[model samples]
Target: NKQGRRQSTISLSTGSGEPISLSMPASGERRLAFMDLLLKHHINGGELSEEDIREEVDTFMFEGHDTTAMAMSWIIYLLGHNMEVQDRLALEVDSLFDDLHSEMRNESNSSSTTEITLDAIKQLKYLDCVVKEGLRLCPSVPLIGRSATEDMTISGHVVPAGTVIYCFIYQLHRDPEIFPDPEVFNPDRFLPENSGGRHPFAFVPFSAGPRNCIGQKFALAELKIVLARLIRHYRFVSLDQP
Candidate 1:
């Protein structure tokens, strides 16, 4: 609602026979950053108490680190299970490293150590696809829920206001219509050409929209660096392998 005024809200039946309406005070003004909003403005009726702020900060730290770590571990597991994919990733990253080193060696100060800068990591296009595909197969946060502040229709289904919408991101990622052979670990699924005409929301590994994961870019970069370095140095073998 706006200014504490009751807005037309919907009640969602949570399968427990109880209809519940979830509401939060409408944002008055947009701030430059989330921290600015958190620190400056009063949201959801009034200013968030110190305890609320601390909880928010703690949630971010815990969720961000845990989700990224799990996603990276899942990616490593996928690579281990698929030797051909692992080999391909290694080959791609090796080529990228070779190019980067060659370019660095060409510098006048050839003694400068070659390091994986952000720009250098971005050059690994194949690795990016691999990461995206891995996320699609195994999303860290499998579910997300949002409430409808207003009445809306989705796919011809009328969703009343105040209705809680629970999205199963894991199922969405594996939707056969959106991703053919969705269960397969095929990095090519995310290739620019291959992914053309796909629904943007088909992949929600880190959720999406206004409340999407704030550290998604940082997490992806970290995952790429860790995976690239590890793959370049060692070949991972699955436990199932004799």
Candidate 2:
């Protein structure tokens, strides 16, 4: 996927005739960037065509920019109205960071530094639960659609091939059978002790399957990092009347 234009070049022209090039990144310099990965997939003949790469890039931009921001907004709103949950999550984040700093101090003998790496974020267990419950309560994408690839019988109803199936994520997440007191913003519902045997499909905010969102992990990591930093620095308060 060298930007050197070795194998192929693709571009789109605007009404003004200005070409927008899908310039490839330099070779052997994969920096874990999304565009670089998309270009690599395209240049390496890895099942992604030029058009597919274009669509993927567009989708990635939208999801990364908009939906993830929406998720954070909803999580902050939930935390605002529920200060108890916010305080508890903040405590978890603080404890983890303190321990991380202590480890750094011991390693450095005299100096201590903090970095919010994946390992550090993983220890913020309560923060993880808070994000999950926020998503369950207010999914950024409230619904997802899929088409049946083959004929299937679902609870006596016949679903033929190519039949479009739509999943209402909001309703599914609020199923009283799956989530007791569904309207409540209880992050503990996602705690391992309380979530021992929940259905896999009970909470699919991003939809579950092979075709599921590719950015889910990256989005969650971003959420944790941003939320961790925000909660540590400031407390959110809802000024609106409930």
In candidate 2, how many Å is residue 101 off? 1.7
RMSD of each: 10.7, 4.5
How many times do residue backbones clash in model 1? 2
Q: Please, what is the TM-score per model?
A: 0.75, 0.78
**Which residue pairs show collisions in model 2?**
none
**lDDT string, candidate 1, 1-242, tens digits:** 25653332334344487955433334554433654445443344446664565566556666867788888898999898999989998998889888778877787547555677788789888899999998998888889999999999999999999999999988888889888898899999988999998887888887889999888889899999888889888988889866
Which tens-of-lDDT digit does each residue in 147-189 have in candidate 2?
9999999999999999999999989999999899999999999
Task: Pick the lDDT winner.
Answer: 2
> What is the Cα root-mean-square deviation between model 2 and the actual structure?
4.5
lDDT scores of the candidates, listed in order: 0.79, 0.86
